[model samples]
Target: MAATRACLVALVVALTFLFMEGRVTAEPTSAGSLVQRRREMGSLLRRLNKPPIASIQSPDGDVIDCVHISKQPAFDHPLLKNHTIQMRPSYNPRGMHHDSNITTHAITQIWHQNGTCPENTIPIRRTKEEDLLRASSIRRFGKKMPRSIPHLNPTNDTDTPNILRGHQHAVASAQYDKCYGTKSTFNLWKPWIARGNDFSLTQFWITGGSYNGNNLNTIEAGWQVYPNLYSDSNTRLFIYWTRDAYQSTGCYNLLCSGFIQTSNQITIGGSISPMSTYGGTQYDIDILVWKDQAGGNWWLQVGGDYVGYWPSSIFSYLADSASTIMWGGEVFSPDAGQTSTHMGSGHFPNEGFGKASHIKNIQVVDSSNCLNPTSDVGFITEQNNCYNVQSDTYGDWGTYIYYGGPGNNHNCP
Candidate 1:
């Protein structure tokens, strides 16, 4: 019996040794995989960080590089190799209302503290190695996940209504037969992000085609707080486009070779200073995107400056006209239980002007190239308990909507 007990103990010890040895043997393979990933990341960085005419160090810890307009990343695309840069739009939309009540505070990037880019050059936010590492993978470094755009009509079968995967929104939308453009003024704020990957934004979506068809062409521009993308919580101006529902075409800002930027004063993906506070002086930026009837290129105007254009040759649907336009706040959280990321001012629309975030002076361009105030607007909120939207048309504001909320409050959770 003693000999049998001793044999049992010995067997147990031998099994433990084998398990420990297996774990030890796995470390080198895991280390080798990490080494391979780093090597690939380094190669990608070299291709992205182009030779700059000059570089400026931003107060927000960003490095803005001024590259020659002709040598910008947009030319890297095979489609844009022979593309001639359109200095300005061929036709500017008319019938813009001159609202005297609009303040001219003028939103500018924090990088301007040092200096502005020289003429015939465009400012670009420099990409860093850490920025690539923060992403899920090198392939998706500057690209949003598939199906990131909000679905207009989500089914009621799920617990969360009107949500597209992990994305939530409180937006106002307008649909038309052949809409040429849309414009809005968005109140800026630095909302709280629950996690590193979660993001909050307010932008205009000029969309054509359908997500079901896999040809959802869209152009989005506005301000966002995406720590994972920028590696900081600073409110930065951003632009994004996807010709095929974000599957394999297009990316944010100039990360990929799509949008050709023209403005020397504004840097795409640069931080915007003087964010709006609760019940304080509000800061805002004007975003206008209109298709030039003559050139067929879609032009984007930020504040009073004509930033640049998305060539007509790159898009299949948006090249003609947009069928629908949306404006307002959207938040993204990868957590299954929902993140605590705040949207807009982190207050409900009922909080009103000084306290709530707003997008006012909404307008849509008709086929005749005349911009008109939209009256037929529909507001949709994915989860009312989490976030909501309220709109009103009065005074010079003109069809304004105050939208947003704290993400994981008592009512929301």
Candidate 2:
């Protein structure tokens, strides 16, 4: 019996020793760690689920889908909404009515500290009417037009109409936005309108630049969510730029010479139908436009591909450290009497679901050269009568937004 007991004890000890060894082996090592495993899985998934090269048409009605560029996420890194926009009194007075009429020379002088902008802040430029008119007169179509097409984004404020719903902004703060980049996501809205008149659609402002007492030009870049701007009913991508506050010098992508497009793949004013694609998360335009650290050029990445850039020379304020960045929507009302033309999906931001438009995944590149989530939020707009914005927490998606509304419905006419 004693001999049997001794043999049993030895077997138990041996089994315990094997279990300990197995655990140590299971532990991650320097090279083959959990991070490595996740990266490998991500790469495989991207390859398997890679979207085919898009066949896009140019604004001039040309079949221009020549290159296959992969989709990129909205930002270089995951965007966290840690910081909020720090709006100055002059920028958004009486609550959140940002200077919608900022283009007027009347708003040219900086209201904050006489344009000296306290230390660490950049000067703000308010474009004059004359400059905007000059820029609007010039037209630079990317490809030769088969025939004459009406000019887009009229430089003359009088020429542009506001058939779409008016806009109220929920801007970001520059005090903490010392970040390198800023990005947002939104569902592509399809604005419906009458056949003869140009439908007023949606446009957002990504305003930034250095401001001087003179030469009030701020580099303005953002996607104008316009559909029928080319006179077609299809929902097309319309890009816009204002190197010197919508002056004739800088036009949309590849339209004018100053903005150099490096990639031929991305079709400016490309069509994005069925805006929302289904899989796990809803569909959206995940775009990240940032200034190159060294060159001071503005580069825009739609989805995943490095489409192209706006050279630094085009922007006096953007070429250096930009003092401000505005993210919000706008629509041109061609006629005050006309109200059928809608801005977003023709629904209020509170309408939620498939009806509204939004700019989500809001993030900015910080002074650290990292994309840190911003904090201390401020929200509002000049014309709450037009539309409104609501910030919400979207599970793992972080804080997304619900914005937009129908036109001509609310005592607008």
Candidate 3:
């Protein structure tokens, strides 16, 4: 029995050696050792099921998140030779509104690179010194500044008289008397009716008339300041009426007729039409200034619409400087025998009457300045058009030649 026990012990030792060497072995003789081995095998299997850890970086070079591959093999493990380290980066892959630390230079760089701005990015530029200086000058001198000429504001204070009535009456009587149903004769050489150096005048009236069955004698009537004297040709400024009842047809008709004159002459004319074909409404009584372009050329614009243009060959002479100005009340047609009956013979019942229209403010603008002011360029002459009627009013319309009222002051007796 002792020999049998010895043989059994030897067999168990051999089996233990074979098991430790990873070879197939018989049952273990010690149950405690077998239990310990089984526990260790379980621990190894559990570790194999755990994930592997991976590190990821953000775009800004910051460490974002760390992930553990619990089920995948380790990167350097020999058993994972057929598998690759997939390494899906752990990151907050979502959009963000990044408004912090934004700089102009950085934005410029981005624009240069992308050729366009990104969404929600507004591009801003620094103002130049010259632009600042020009703006400041305009503010100081109002419309007197050359750069603020296009944006000249309309004046209030209807009392001031800048239109020369006598001159306008003479021209109208000579040009459209027959069409206006009047027989008055206009004397162009009258000393009192001649234009001054400034080309300013008062003493005019707005007239409305009809010719040859058609109402062609309609115009915004007022004294016009031309760039020269002795001719009803070129003008600089025109002051007329502002009453809404007489404005609609008269304003547009004057735009069509007066736009034919080719020179730097400002023509003030109107009509009494109660309706207009342009829109279906009557316009407020208003004045218009026809700006003569370089060649006997001219442009007719009212409020903001560019109504018409005249070629340069129509005028006898063109006014080059703003200083050479004349004042008159009427406009003459060189070709009286034209197809339109109102073209000639100043004795029309509608042409020669000098009735006063409800006059309003005067406007002075510098054409030399190309910049448009903040004010509405078209509606400058309408009522309540000034910024400040008290102080800014005088700057826009000019002070009254005599008494200070509204429409009454527009005439120089």
Candidate 4:
């Protein structure tokens, strides 16, 4: 009985050991199997839920949006290809929010058809009144007119007669002897004068014709001080011409006629026809000086208006001693066939005949000082009396009056 009992006890101990070993091994295997099943199920679910690779089209070109997954089960799947993903119409968060009601394909089509993404669309606003005003101002005055004339060759003493004399006949429509005088008073005959030893009366000339055998028409002549003459330290020159009136209509009408050549050969601004003229009032032409800051250079502006400007080089020519400056008769060439005929009909009109151009003021100012003060006053003021002068009989005034101003004076009406 004792041996049997001992054997039973041993068997029971073996069974217990076996059962413990089975439990230990089976626990790990079962757990591992469950984990593997879970992983497979997750992958299948991801595949079922995964969006298809989509091709996107834009007006600019084509692009692709694709999904990708890692082969390693340890890594999570990614919706887009690594580093290969591109911007597409559907991916824009803002566009998605704004266009929630619209179809994704429609939104994509809009972007593609537009050539750019819809999020980038922006509406251009209209210009405001202030902007319009600013633009108008720019259009009116910002742009500058280009220079019309170029520098001319230097003039010598001999060339003076040919230029001045020929211009006298052509300009005056007649021929007359050149003379010099100091009388401040106006004269119809011998209308030129040479001041001091350095300046000659040949510097001035006069030309005109008889209108209806009544009004004696005349234009003054002068040599443009060559560009070289302005350099002479000893040369301090003053030139003057006069217009007198028998009546208000008789004085030389500056608006109707006047011209001046610059030392550089460029013609300063003058009127081919009356821009402004008061028959009895005297108008004076003078040279104004200017300097450019860039090169520290000087320029002479003729006729007060910006129409004519001469560089220091041209000023030097005018100041040179080798050239004889002529004024009055056409300082250029004579108009072909008009010279003798103009001289023959020398009728001085009692009402509109010989009148003098008066010099009321003289001033020297920088280029900035030469600005047109009434630039914003509009066309009426510009076309009229912006120069503080009145209109002429012909009702036309050149741009000079607006530029050449007695600023606030309305002397010529």
Q: Candidate 4, which segments miss by more than 4 Å at Cα? A: 1-165, 169-298, 302-309, 313-327, 331-413
Q: After superposition, how far is residue 353 of candidate 1 from its true place, in Å?
A: 0.6
The digit string of per-residue lDDT tens for model 1 on 201-272 reads 999899998776678899999999998789899999999999998999989999989899899999999999
Q: State each model's C-alpha RMSD to the native.
A: 9.1, 24.8, 40.8, 42.5
Off by over 4 Å in 2: 1-61, 65-179, 194-204, 209-229, 277-282, 336-338, 375-377, 380-382
Candidate 4's residue-wise lDDT over 177-216, tens digit each?
3211100111111111111101111122221222122222
Best by lDDT: 1
Instruction: Give each model a TM-score.
Output: 0.90, 0.56, 0.21, 0.20
Worst 10 residues of 4 by lDDT: 89-98
Q: What is the C-alpha lDDT of each candidate?
A: 0.84, 0.42, 0.23, 0.21
Location of the lowest summed lDDT over 10 successive residues in candidate 3: 180-189
Rank by TM-score (best first): 1, 2, 3, 4
lDDT of 3 by residue, 103-167 (tens): 21110111122222222221211112222122212122111111111111125222222122111
Using lDDT as the measure, what is the rank order of every candidate, best first? Answer: 1, 2, 3, 4
